[model samples]
Target: MNETSNNTVIDERSDILETLAKHRHFLRFTTRDLTDEQAGQRTTASELCLGGLIKHVTSTERNWADFIQRGPAAMGDFKNMTEADFAKRADDFRMLPGDTLAGVLAAYEEVAAATDKLVADLPDLNASHPLPEAPWFEPGARWSARRVLLHIIAETAQHSGHADIIRESLDGAKSMG
Candidate 1:
């Protein structure tokens, strides 16, 4: 019987993949029915905007997925990044004049699909990679694929909260349905 046909036999990916999908749904929900400009609006003192958060999470997930395949070297000299490189990375979170809610949302969905497929294909979540050198991270830390997946979930959850507050402040729209 096909995996889909055998509903009684729970799939290995159900826990991590399903939970992440639910959170991604909530994050995408926060942006619904908003114009491009509205999506880019910052109603609070914090710099976060809904569209920007979408962009940030999309980029963050894609990069981390690449790291899973390519390891710490894929992170590429984080310790030596200049102010301009840092500035450029920071700008990814904001919706520039040309950025649209639809575009960011589309990119996010693409990342989601790719990650779900990756999880399904992996033979061992225990596969490990050395973390890049960063002051924000502990020295010589290594993360297994399972740990990386969990970290992705954590990042999404935190950003979802930020998006919710920003959405509410923008137009009194609550995300918890």
Candidate 2:
């Protein structure tokens, strides 16, 4: 690539990574000073809780990043899971037995580090893979690495909003204030 192109690549990766870091900061900030039980409390009518949202975002981003590295099938075989199996996957959001806020936060940091590295190391953001089949996803779709990063950002920001509401409801504490 030419010098200008190289600079643009660097700038794009830096921009995405910085935005992800900013969102992550706010997400973690919302969970501060919470016991495991408190983190799992559902403060709103929705099933979402602060701890659950944390786990969900971690898993989601990790899976997408892995997809960027290893392709869509890296997400695993979900074609024939039993209803009970599906139920357990659904519980991935909750702070289940043996789960803690600290553990989840630590895992998030690890995933973020690995994902940022992958983003920087990729030759081009245009790298893509066929998306895994899912009920919500359109059939035969492909997602570029750039799209994956954007999705992660969107997911993180969306859950951050949910977490903000849950956190404020839990103890009347604002996430930023």
Which candidate number would show the highest TM-score if scored against the true structure? 2
lDDT of each: 0.88, 0.89
Task: Work out the TM-score per prediction.
Answer: 0.92, 0.93
**Cα lDDT for residue 119, candidate 2:** 86
Tell me which residue pairs clash in candidate 1.
Answer: none
- Please write out the lDDT profile of model 1 over residues 21-74, one tens digit for every residue: 988999999999999999998889998899999999998899888888889987
Q: Which ten residues in a row have the lowest lDDT in candidate 1?
A: 3-12
* Model 2 TM-score on a 0 to 1 scale: 0.93
Model 1 TM: 0.92
For candidate 1, the per-residue lDDT at 64 reads 86
Scanning candidate 2 in windows of ten residues, the lowest lDDT window is 1-10
* Residue-level lDDT tens digits of model 2 in 152-172: 999999899889999999999
Which residue pairs in candidate 2 have backbone atoms (N, alpha carbon, C) closer than 3 angstroms, thus clashing?
52-93
